[model samples]
Target: MEEIRKIIHIDMDAFFASVEQLDRPELRNKPIAVGGDGDRGVVAAASYEARKFGVRSAMSSKIAKKRCPQLIFVRGRHDRYKEVSKQIMNIFHEFTDLVEPLSIDEAFLDVTHNKKNLPSATLIAKEIKKRIKEVTGLTASAGISVNKFLAKIASDVNKPDGLFAIPPKDVEAFIEDLQIDKFYGVGKVTADKMHKLGIFKGKDLKKKSLLELSRLFGKHGAYYYNISRGIDERSVNPNRIRKSVGTEHTYQSDLIDTKEIKKDIQKTTQSLVRRLEKSDFKGRTITLKLKYSNFEQETRSRTLLQIIQGEEMIQKLAEDLLDQEELKTSIRLIGLTISNRINESEPMQLTIDF
Candidate 1:
């Protein structure tokens, strides 16, 4: 009775690593890792060659080196990556305005009312992939389905320049065969819990009633149940604004003294303020995060009536948070974030009353 929505998930294959390879022909077909080669640096992206040696993104450079001694590490160029991302997004817009970027390298497009009025979503996906390659010299994998959940899963089925589609008729069967860990939003913690309960696949997930799942996982359980049935009502939202801009760092040695903590806070605030200035952002909220040596974490935030900026304002907020927190243990990490974006829907009301 209802028309099935046409959703497409497009993901760049080894985005950052691939970009490095494309820029340097010599690095092509070689094991390349994009990240800092420093002791404290972590791998941002690993090429397919490096991945074969068990190197992965987010792994410490030390561990990655242990995994692959010959791994070629390169520093990341955020400006270059951002430039490439813009080119790819422009290509996506050629097909549909309902494009929702998940990250710099991935996006979801609802092409139900495509510009070309193509009858088959598969054709649209092929054209998009072709365009991405032609424009950016990078390959993309695409998944076409009736909703976001199914489309995202399909995109990963055949990676590194591949396309897969799930017809509406085969949705249930396709989901039943999916591994529990492979489901979207089911991280390591959730997967371990599911395994303990003897749930290993989508079929096992489907057997549990919504109420039973809710009892086990609280609110997220309902989401799991619905996804298992290939039912995701969430639309591809294009107007999603950048919610927050933040940065954090983990110390090699724990900090115990107030002076040391304040110094670290000052450094963090300086970095955050610089970023805000570069982005032309004026936000009203400042949040401070602290993690103890024992892994206990706490966060404190202050929202102001007027948009705030500069190192002084952020540093003051961080000091307030530090004062409220108990400093019984050494601090392992500290973070600062600023947000409260002004949108067109709501009028920007700037008040001097603070």
Candidate 2:
């Protein structure tokens, strides 16, 4: 029998927007967003006040403004965010070396056997939350459970400044009532498919057998089957892995013509290729990302037999992917990315709190 693990997931509340408010007191208790406010600008983060009006991350600045005219926009300061992140990270290290940062503002910790030798993961989460506020003057929400998946989902239950836990005894009850969309990997696309299959909640998901799920969802079928019953055995890795390299260009105006979109993709791919060469990175997969004027985004990727990093090859693949689709929508951003190693070990699950 495997020893039951204790995991905690910590996520900063409205991270970018909160940082902006911390630096500018005038922006507190008011609506704010962080990112470019130009024609090609996208909202990287939205304050709690802004979110009340349906303003959100990845929304176009123009659309955000229309939704909330008084919304304040601030440029993101990555350096300052990094400085604060380091402080919070130090606190985690003081407790355990099993910290896995999902993003700058979020991380997972396996405290089953920590340096402090604490027996209760809930206590550690509470102390960590308190320490982060005292040191960084920012609020963070924490989730504690027996595994990484449960901890991550629990953390979001109480947003902004809250702590939630899912004990082993309550795991089944917790997951059974959880909605399908609340699952870690189930996004809008997956939720719709699950809905069609009458899998709206954890209970519904559990009704599907392993073979049926595998047939419907392919490789991810097994994942759903396990999680529906609150079983996630994945370990917490401390390594901060760099998985991919990519670049995106937001046009000043929507590129309606296929010729214009192709040109933009070519330029962006060339720049990424040069960067890849400089870093001596080798990858076999190429992904194309397109963001339409309405803020809808899509990605297409292809993996080849050999590691390829040629600009023409990347450009051609991107073009081919775009060519297969009808240009019905005007595009405001074009991007290309190359994925690196396929980790046969535990693949990282990175989540961003919206």
Q: Model-by-model lDDT, in order?
A: 0.87, 0.86
Error of 2 at 196 (Å): 1.1
Off by over 4 Å in 1: 245-298, 302-324, 327-338, 341-354
Q: Which numbered prediction scores highest in TM-score against the true structure? A: 1
Which residue pairs come into collision in candidate 1?
Answer: none
True-vs-predicted CA distance for residue 29, candidate 1, Å: 0.8
- lDDT (Cα, tens digit) per residue for candidate 1, span 302-325: 888767776677888889888886
Instruction: Give the per-residue Cα lDDT of candidate 1 at 23.
Output: 98
176-222: candidate 2 lDDT, tens digit per residue: 99999999988776898899989999999999999999999889999
| Total clashing pairs in model 2 | 0
> What total of clashing residue pairs does each candidate reach?
0, 0
- What is residue 136's positional error in candidate 2, in angstroms? 0.6
Alpha carbon lDDT at 15, candidate 2: 88
Q: How many clashes would you count in candidate 1? A: 0
